[model samples]
Target: MQDYLELFFNLIKQPIIQAVLCVIGSILAAKIADWIIGRVLSNLANRTSSTIDDNIIQILHRPIYYSILFIGLGISVKAFSLPEVLSFVLLGLFKTIAVIIWSFALFQSFMHFITWYGRQGKKDNVF
Candidate 1:
């Protein structure tokens, strides 16, 4: 048993293995985030009087997932010990993608809120 445990530990010490584990961990984290937003947060949002909160939560789910995924990927890339320039570029790319995704989500959520507010105003004859 000790021999097997030692072998497993040795294998896990490899950079490639570590990188793969990081990627897998990131995916799992993203999925957990999705589940939380979909199941737990959705339930909370549903209890609210306004649907805007629900829509905002739904919009945020993907951005949050992809942000976590990109961060992990960036770490994995660094684990490979590539040239500094290459690592910098790859990390920058991941950071850019995360920013873009979050920006898009924020824009979408804001638009949804604006539209909902407009509808409410119309219903109240405040328009």
Candidate 2:
């Protein structure tokens, strides 16, 4: 029994297993986040008159989901005792993905706000 328990512990400590676990955990987290955003946040956004909130919510949904995924992936990659160059490259790739996703989301939100502002101005005859 003791030997079996030791072997199990050793297997669990393997880098590949740890990485897979991290990915699975991240995926589950992303799903939960998506569910909350789709059901609860969307309902709240719909209750409001302005569509700006809705747009913001829409812009945020995917980036937030991907961010969680990337975070998990980064952690998983770091769990492996990778060589310095490979580790650096992988971490950099994950960071780049995060930056791109967030920047795109912000750009989209900005565009939506500008459109809404323009509509308001037109309605008020300010422009």
Candidate 3:
């Protein structure tokens, strides 16, 4: 039993196994996040009159999901102990992707708010 346990630990310590576990954990986390965003927060947003909450939820959903995925991928790659140059390249790529995802979400949310404000302005005869 002790030998079997030691063997199991050794097998799990392999880089590939670590990477796979990281990826799986990240995916499961992303799914749970998505479900909460899609169901719970969305329901709460529906109860409110302001569109801000709704816009925020919408804008954040995909970025948050993909960010989790990227983080997982990054961890998985790091586990492989790749060449320094390759590791840095992957890190840079993930950073760029995260920035793009966040920027796009911000832009989308800003546009949504602007549109909502415009409608409000029209309703108030301010424009």
Candidate 4:
């Protein structure tokens, strides 16, 4: 038993193994998050009268998934310990991706809000 444990620990210590595990874990985590959001929170949101909750839920999927993926990729990059220039470029790319994901989500949420507001105004005869 102790020998098996030691072997397992040794295997986990390798950088490549660590990187792979981190990536796999991140993917699983993101999937779990998506499931929870889609199955659990979605039901809760559906119970509400407002479309805003539903729209917000829909907007959240990409940012959440990409954020998790980027975090894993960043960790894996460090584990590999490549050239400084390469590492810097890779990290920058990841950051850019993250920023784009969140920015699009924000833009989409804002659009949904505007649409809802317009409908409200129309219903109230205020527009």
Candidate 5:
């Protein structure tokens, strides 16, 4: 039974340090994204009113949440080491994340366009 259990987990040979490194990378990436979002919102708010600040905050929030989730998943992957079982799942996860990021980018662009159009409409009304 012990041999069988060992055989079950044999694939996950990566060291704790490697997994830790990956987690650290994910965390750093999240923090960097946070700072970027903050700075961008600050700059935009300076340029205009506070209306767009809320949208920027909302857009930035989910990526930070998902980055930490991804780190948890990476740590678990290191422990499970069942690549054969998890390969497809991991692939799907990556694709899902990519889609989410793309969606956020597209949504942000749309919001920016709307704001610009609204501002232009106000100008036209004033003239």
Candidate 6:
């Protein structure tokens, strides 16, 4: 058991393994940002009254935000083979994108939900 454990640790110490882990870590970070944005969007949508805006916001923000962030992260992580400073710079940009995505997703959700419910109110009170 000790021998096997040592062998596993040694393999993880390789440069290639580190590179792979960095890429996987970046992807996992992207997924986490995705989840956080979705949750924030849900909360904002529930709070606001404009269902149309909320829906439209969601429609506009959902895929584009995630796609851009994820693609950017993937491209940035691919730069791991570059200089050390470049890798760190790429990570910084990736984090910025994650923040942007999170903020926009929340904004879009609140806007679209407000639009949706606001229209619903108009219909309901028209009687």
Total clashing residue pairs per candidate?
Answer: 0, 0, 0, 0, 0, 19
- Candidate 2 residue runs with Cα over 4 Å from true position: 1-8
Using TM-score, give the best candidate's number.
Answer: 4
> For candidate 3, lDDT tens digit of each residue in 9-38?
998999999989989989999999999999
Q: Output the lDDT of residue 85, model 6.
A: 81
- Give all TM-scores, in the order shown: 0.91, 0.88, 0.89, 0.92, 0.53, 0.46
Candidate 1 local lDDT, 1-127, one digit each (tens): 9999999999999999988999999999889988998999999999999999999998999999899899889888877777899999999988888889999999999899999999999999996
TM-score of 5: 0.53
RMSD of each: 1.4, 1.9, 1.6, 1.3, 8.0, 6.7
User: Which candidate, 3 or 4, has the higher TM-score?
Assistant: 4
Give one digit per residue, the lDDT tens place, for model 2 in 1-127: 9999999899889999898899999999999999999889999999999999999999999999999998999899888768889989998998998899999999999999999999999999999
Residues 1-127, model 5: lDDT tens digits:
9998786566335555456556667777777776766777556666766455566665656666576657656565655455765856884686589578858866886787688778878978953
Candidate 1 runs further than 4 Å off: 125-127
Candidate no. 2 TM-score: 0.88
Local error of candidate 3 at residue 4 (angstroms): 3.3
Candidate 4: lDDT of 30?
Answer: 84
As a whole number from 0 to 100, the lDDT of residue 58 in candidate 4 is 89
What lDDT would each prediction earn against the true structure? Answer: 0.91, 0.94, 0.92, 0.91, 0.66, 0.65
> For candidate 6, what is the lDDT?
0.65
Ranking by lDDT: 2, 3, 1, 4, 5, 6
lDDT of 4 by residue, 33-122 (tens): 889888898899999998998999989887998898898889888897778999999999999999998999999999999999999999
Q: How big is the RMSD of model 1? A: 1.4
lDDT of 3: 0.92
Descending-TM-score candidate ranking: 4, 1, 3, 2, 5, 6
Which candidate's lDDT is highest?
2
Candidate 3 residue pairs in backbone clash = none
Q: Report how far residue 25 has shifted in candidate 3, in Å.
A: 1.0
